[model samples]
Target: MTRPVVATIAALFKRGHVLLVRRANPPDAGRWGFPGGKVDLGESLEDAAVRELAEETGIQATAKQVFTAVDAFDHDESGVLRHHYVLVAVLCSWVSGKPLAGDDALEARWFPIEQLGSADLALSLDVEKVAKLGAQIHSNRAFELGF
Candidate 1:
């Protein structure tokens, strides 16, 4: 039986910038993405998000809200589904520590929202979409808060 993998993504933002990590694992290795990973058994999605973010970016943060869930599927040469993931993206605010590459991240850096689509960044489609949406949502939230 095939089961969909459950994962979480931390869309961490601070001072008009978002955190991005270059993946070090297969399925999209060396591609820029948010810091996140599969949700561990018996762990809450929010907790997993926090843990993954810290593990990948070395920055402690908490999920303030879940923004969206994205369906990601990888296909094999025969057109069969190799992997499917339901990734829940959570908007988080940085709590402490500096950004450092860890776990499945080859590198971690912060980029301004406008630069997310820059040619030099080489972001994946999904990453770009999520980053843009996350930035918009965060901006709206800040506006609501009168910040």
Candidate 2:
């Protein structure tokens, strides 16, 4: 793509666990990560994150605030950039619904926060760091106070 596309990710946390989806598309196929996708025209960032979460994992969540932003640069074997996405990570609280793979996701489930970054799981590069930080942020009292 000529210009970097904007995307949003939901770092939804609940009861010490975080929701994840195994992506079924290129760029990071079969890798576990937060549910997200491109922000629709005129849609707010948090709204896009929540919408993607529900669409990809059948999970409903309340977007708290933006957690972080990261770049996903896809490169060909020849080291040429193919696609780049500016991903805004949103911290969210689990509201309802169980994760069921939909949209461009192959599988969906909740994983213990402690399992993040485990060698056994094939996660997108930033999943572990984002999740750990998100969980900590969600647990803080300020999270509930909406500060």
Candidate 3:
């Protein structure tokens, strides 16, 4: 069995918009998603998030609160033994630099909260659900707990 470990960062900007990247590889090729990637050896989660964000979107961000954690399970087309992933999603704020697509990203852009449902998001169901919750928390909307 092969277990794929991945980490993703949800960069929320403009108070109500979230950053999304169009993937260049499979598992969701050409679909939109948050900026992130696999955690490299000898790197902290925060550092990995920042590094992945910069590598994929050309944006420097500071990792804030840990928004969510998700575990996903699936099988490949060849019926190979594939284990699930424990994805750590962190909330990030823009530090500097403009976004430019790179690495596994075909494009990068910000999408409004209201448009999330209509966007061609390619993340897992668990990720998408957590992202929506994170967005609400960042938005400071009618939700309780004060984010």
Candidate 4:
């Protein structure tokens, strides 16, 4: 079986809040995660990230830089190697338009930085780590520029 290459974009909003979406489909239905989807044909990773973010959440953003990459593989109960993804997460700041849940996302909300570690958060460890890294980058930039 051929493995899937997926690219994901995570939006880190102001006030240390990250956007989390509830998936509307299977593989991880009803679970909360960063707003993103699979990369489309002939699309660059950065473009894919921008597209997925707009599709999953009604927010437009520019993918500034890649903050993290994660390789994940999983099998089903039937021992089928069902899911695999090379998730490329990019750091993005909101550019235009207020966000609303859209496409594969059942819902969307701003999750505070502290809330990420709570048991209620269903995202993977890598997701949280990348978000923290993004936040750190933002913080550093702010400090340097005296924002």
Cα lDDT tens digits for candidate 2, 1-147: 299999999998878898999999967999998999999999999999999999999888888899799999989889999999999999987788998999999999999999986899999988999998888888894567764
Ranking by TM-score: 2, 1, 4, 3
Candidate 3, residues 51-137: lDDT per residue as tens digits?
Answer: 888998888888877767776554688976465656788777778877789999999887776777764555545545666887766
Better of 2 and 4 by lDDT: 2
TM-score against native, each model: 0.92, 0.93, 0.80, 0.87
Candidate 3 regions off by >4 Å?
4-6, 78-83, 119-124, 140-147
Which 10-residue window of candidate 4 scores lowest in summed lDDT? Answer: 5-14
Would you list the C-alpha lDDT of every candidate in the order shown? 0.88, 0.91, 0.72, 0.76
75-127, model 4: which lDDT tens digit per residue? 68787877788788877778876668889888888888778878867875466
lDDT-based ranking, best first? 2, 1, 4, 3
Which residue pairs does candidate 2 place in steric collision? none
lDDT of 4: 0.76
Q: Which candidate achieves the best lDDT against the true structure? A: 2
